[model samples]
Target: MSEWVDVHFQALETCGKRARTAANMLTVEDVFQDSSAKQPADAAQASMFGDLSHSGALAGKVNDVWTALKEELGTGRSRLQGVEKAIDQVETNLRKATRAATV
Candidate 1:
């Protein structure tokens, strides 16, 4: 049972790491996407530049999404930390219980 509990905590740790990595990736993606600007290839196309207000708004929306994801990732990390503490307590209790049974 203790071994199984250890395995579960390992899985949780991996999940937490993945969540942090994904959150970091989202930040990088937003930076790259924001820096992107569509340019016309020729004089005629330059004169026909389309309105980019919508693009700006869309980018804002995406940034908002990234912010939300980061918040969720933080929450997940906190939960994993709590679970790890709980697992330690459980293992301690199991040790005591085993000792009592042997006595």
Candidate 2:
């Protein structure tokens, strides 16, 4: 005989909400503009490279990395939203099943 497994849909919902909240809080502007580390990053690049051409390259690379991070976060948020939708569908189906069974 197979044992019954309990699924905590509420906990899953809470997790989804927390993840979305975190993702929303870390917007591209917040990461780039509002960050305290921007000046330090520029200084470090300039100190290490020590030339105008290399400085430009390092700056471009840094910008590219930030852009990539932003894109990745957006993708993650979209995927989490999809998961939330799936969870809602599953909960709805389970409720319908329980109701039909009781009837």
Candidate 3:
């Protein structure tokens, strides 16, 4: 005889929804659009201070860091979406199996 396992479909659905919502909210544009660090660094690079070679190097470093952060956020969003999809699939499969067994 196999052991019976209880699965909470509603809770899984809720968790999937939450993960999707979180993933949607994790966009780079939304998070970094109004960043003070980016604005100042960009301004500094575009202004007279940019004439200095050292200023350009510093600006480059800042841009690199900014790009890395955006990439990380994108990666995180992708992972969250993947998890949400997997959860949805699991819920669907479980429900189908339960129905088939009852019939």
Candidate 4:
């Protein structure tokens, strides 16, 4: 019985890991689907997870999702900053253009 209990525990941990992954993916998907302009919050539960009622596991999954989203937002912001800088340079160069250059 004890051995079986350990096996069950391992199974639960695996389930938890998979659940976390699904929740994270759902979160990103929602971001794209719901509000294409803003990042979405993490998922705290799924159909199976709700049945298990493991609130801790649910919250943990949400945290994992949130962290992943935060990372993605950071990357996106970095890229946007680069593009903005490029645009600014182009505008400055255009404004500074001489009549001779334009002709």
- Which candidate number has the best lDDT? 3
1 against 3, candidate with superior lDDT? 3
Tens digits of lDDT, candidate 4, 1-103: 2466456556555655554444444434455765547553445545535666776777778779788876886566555555555655554454456334656
Which candidate number would show the highest TM-score if scored against the true structure?
A: 3
TM-scores vs. true structure, each candidate: 0.47, 0.60, 0.75, 0.38
Lowest summed lDDT window (length 10), candidate 4: 19-28
lDDT of 1 at 65: 72
Off by over 4 Å in 2: 1-9, 29-51
Report how far residue 15 has shifted in candidate 1, in Å: 12
RMSD in angstroms, all models?
9.0, 5.8, 4.5, 23.7
lDDT tens digits by residue: candidate 3, 1-103: 1234343777898899999999998886667666764433342252445476677778667778877877998999999999999999998898788888888
Candidate 1 residues lying further than 4 Å off, grouped into runs, are: 1-51
Scanning candidate 1 in windows of ten residues, the lowest lDDT window is: 38-47
Clashes of 4: 0
Model 1 reaches what TM-score against the true structure?
0.47
- In model 4, the runs with Cα more than 4 Å from the true position are 1-57, 99-103
lDDT of 3 at 61: 75
On residues 35-77, what C-alpha lDDT tens digit does candidate 2 reach at each position? 6655233323555666566786786687788668868878876
Q: Which ten residues in a row have the lowest lDDT in candidate 2?
A: 1-10
Which candidate would rank higher by TM-score, 1 or 4? 1
The model with the greater TM-score, 1 or 3, is 3
Clashes per candidate, residues 3 or more apart or on different chains: 0, 0, 0, 0
